[model samples]
Target: MTPPMTPVCAKPRRRRLAALTALAAVFAVLATACTGGGGTAAQDVQDSYKTLPKESGKPTDGGTATVALTPGLSPNYIYPYPPASANGTVIARGLMWRSLYRPSGEGDQIADTALSLAEAPAYSSDRKTVTIKMKDYSWSNGRPVTADDVVFSLDLLKAALKESPANWSFYTPGQFPDGVTAKATTPDTLTLELDTAYNPSYLLSMLTLLYVMPSEEWNIARTGGPHLDHSDPENAKAIYTYLTKQSESQSTFADNPLWQVVNGPYRLKSFDPTTGSFSLAPNKEYSGPGDSRLDQVDFKSFTSAAAVLNQFKAGKLTVGTLDSSFITQIDALKKQGYHVYGAPAPARFDPLVLNFENTTNNFDKVIARPYVRQALQHLIDQGGYVKSRGVYNGAASPNYSTAGSGSPYPPEFGDQAPYPYDPAAAEKLLTDNGWKVVPDGSTTCERPGTGPGECGAGIPQGQTIDFTLSSANTPAYVGARDIAFASQAKKLGVEVTIETKSLNYLYTNYGNSFAPANKDKWAAQDYGPLYLAAGYPSSNTVFNTGGSFNLGGYRNAEVDKLIEASTFGADPTVLSTEVTSLSKDLPVLFFPTPHTLVVWKDTLSGPPSSFNALLSFLYTPELWYFREQDS
Candidate 1:
């Protein structure tokens, strides 16, 4: 019975001055937001890496913070496509627009830390220029964050080829896209040069993921607003064809004043998305120098993880993402004390793209035999689906797909990852890939099913294998792929069907079309989990089996030469051992990584850590507050 307290939504002071002029087009994508450096993980309270980590376990002020949201998504396009896109819209766009770069945490060098908001960039000895220097600060609506608004939002993310510009992640502004030789050598000084010789620690790590802007309210929104001008690159294929037709409209992100921006420290004061709820407040013209003890916060939105556990058991969402069936009722919510926090949600090792020139299946001949998709990864169960999904224990890990970022799965892919679960080593790698068992344990197909040019139609004869699951995901991903096809894949013969849709027509008409010149317009996608990103060649927009972020059209040639040699690797640890041998072979059916579970209200606290929806929930909302109004 824990969920009562909730407040927020009072706005109207002339819509907080038109929400402070809709935060000037979120600094017009803040000179293309990509910065890095100390935003948390302890740093003497780093004070303001935009927002989050100010009050820690105490420091309340005047109650009010409801937050839970969800329902045809939006709190005005919250961090639109990166900065960890969604975890309650990255904590409501990290309390309304943030990114000048922040992310060191562990409390930056500790000596009571928290005070480096700026001071990390400095490259040029032919490592291809860099410079940066800003941090004089001043925006919630006071203006003036400069370094020419972080080099005009890094020249509009090097004019939108943007794979990961959080300032330099090893420089690939599409290899200097005939631009970003940049300037603004003053107004807080900025530089950047480059023609080659990459990684000045990727522009000092885009200050923990750069997001700054305001150079004339963002180069007058590169003119694509009413017409063309964002400096005009022949209007980049007509503003990506008018934001792909207003991201496919429904009144495009509520009259897009570029989804109401603010430049962090809190401000978006009202939202409803038919009740995913929202409201934030603080910026009485905020400019940083501390003094915001929580005036109002509210955020609701719950459609079932059993209505966020029947609103935590008839209480009404204590606040944000939860339910692994509430971890054995947390000893009755800690004998009614109610801080119950849980974990597990941290998966995205993202694989599953198999167009085999447009599917036909018996699980498309055991995913075209990649060691029988590495013997269905030793019969996956991942600790009984992370204890039937209630999470928190070792907060999830097992994501193998050919490991990356200096590989060897070190200190990152935990909870027994990459290839360990083992059902007789996946029935000895599917009877050494020829496959035949058949006495009762079903197997058969020792090659030879499809005729007309190998594996594609009518697919059957039974030893069983079938697959397909995307009826537009999230009823907890179609009940965790219908309990991994009725509890651990029917003794490995496997069968799954499902198809359900309408998550806005599966994320804008069949989740980024992999290659279906109209196969009844998509919805057969069996599993989902992807993020194969760490910086561009962007696997030719996600493994070029046919680009447009290739949702499925898989094609292999040795997994496209180990995803193009793990995208420009001089050895990011041999590209993390080729992303863990391409996820122990099952190009797709290697599930179990789904962890985003966050639940709060122990009286609010902060800085424990975990977020990858590309991040912004003010990247740390100044490490939370309100512990019974500071003790």
Candidate 2:
């Protein structure tokens, strides 16, 4: 339920994880060039981890590092919890207010205890009661981050949900804060009593989204007013209203007193609304891991990937991502004194979201049929798409299920394509289902009935398989793959009309939950990958019935039960079973998981793990510093 990442521009609302900076990984190395570290980089290009030079030299004093924000995806909201239509990155959240549990960059680990604000939760035997102890952390205002702050944050979150479910995308009507009672039993101890027992892993995953705010500072309903107890429901609601209203005044973000009192590694120094660029200075009061040696970190935004690449070529960008379409430039970028690395981001998947509520061209009825969905899935050439130079350029791996490659909870099919690309198979499935066999022309339903070998209910004779694909306008590969799919569908007599839209536009207007009026406007959308929590890949809010982020109104009784089992049941294997069912159900059209190619200046050195976090679209600039020589 983390923030869903569009391949290029725009990061849609808050969910479980933070904003995705870019796009995935298959470890194949492209050729490497000499680096500023005075070493020949790994040459095979197939080894994903060995491409970057080893960390060298001693840490130096104050230096400013420029980070490239994903093209078109820049921070616009300072609040941790954002509304459904909240377009733009929420990167400022992690930079200022630290989440209770820090997400691990490693695939095998769930949380990074060294960076987390709370110790791991201790669950009662019945599993309905949980206790969490706050770490020794302080806010910029010199106040201890107490358990009362945690309770206050939860209260405000509940208030946001009470106002409207859309205010917080991760919310379900009766889940988490809805039925749980949070208590600050001691200054550092916060306890929770749940109505229903939840899987420990699942509950911990939920805590990753709970960011601790300074209750002492943010408890008031008005600026320059007396601080009220946020534990009161009405007071919490008023405080939420006030904070959200203040968050909308983006012009005052840098100067706002509410925002300056941060608890994370860095504090906002300036924000440019015009360019969506911003700068950060290390918080002297930060009490977390690593030395905040870097004096400043500047985030740069661009209108297109081309502009980012131009900056990289000119050695203007210190840290950023390179588009897969420009894969050929890897060696040249290495020679430009940049360290380039690529990997499939953990717990991430890209799909063409199918809007089942869209009645346009009767697509809802057409796509409802399992055979038809399978046929359409067949039209996608996952392998060819990965191999295509204009597509992923050998930087992506073919993924057939929601449980992406190397998942801890892989489906039964496990990397094998359930519906491998075959135009003949697509045609055969349609023809067997009473569709007229028309090559390169409009095919219609020859037999319309609710019986075997016939078009399903609500579909009539002469019904054509036609729909519009709303494609994102960044990361170029999105359009390339859509065109390829359309061409394949064309050969099968299915018409897929392509319409391009900006990622920002798609993030804001394409979701059925927020923009139900526009449901029929788009049959399908291909914005990009949706990143869940890396260690625990739960589809709670993404695929479950009535999920806030469920852009497509996809519903299935068995799927709902499976999702429920994964959420509340203690059996870890249930996640595999759930994803397996989702894979076969074809709720959304699965696309190849593209490897995000992360490029950074070689002179900027830190623990290699810090750079590795970039592959997952995570920023830990606090751990980074300039080498002594470079500084």
Each candidate's lDDT (Cα)?
0.43, 0.81
Question: Distance (Å) between predicted and true CA of 599, model 1?
Answer: 3.9
What's the CA error at residue 568 for candidate 1, in Å?
Answer: 21
All candidates: TM-score: 0.32, 0.93
Alpha-carbon shift of residue 615 in model 2 (angstroms) = 1.7
Question: Residues 1-631, candidate 2, lDDT per residue (tens digit)?
Answer: 3444422125433221211112111111211110112243322344642365678888887889988887767678887776554554564687789989987777666677788999999999999999999999999977888998898899999988888887776777788778889999999999999999998888887887888898999988888988988878999989998988888888999999999989999999999977789999988899998788999999998878999999998878789998887877888988888888888878888889999999988999999998889999998888767766556767788898786667788898776788988778988899999899787899999999999899889999999999999877677778777777877788788999877776777877888876799999999999877887777787888788888778898999899999899899988689988888998889899889888888988888888878877877678888888887742
- Residue 399 lDDT (model 2): 90
* Alpha carbon lDDT at 311, candidate 2: 91
Indicate the worst ten consecutive residues by lDDT in candidate 2.
27-36
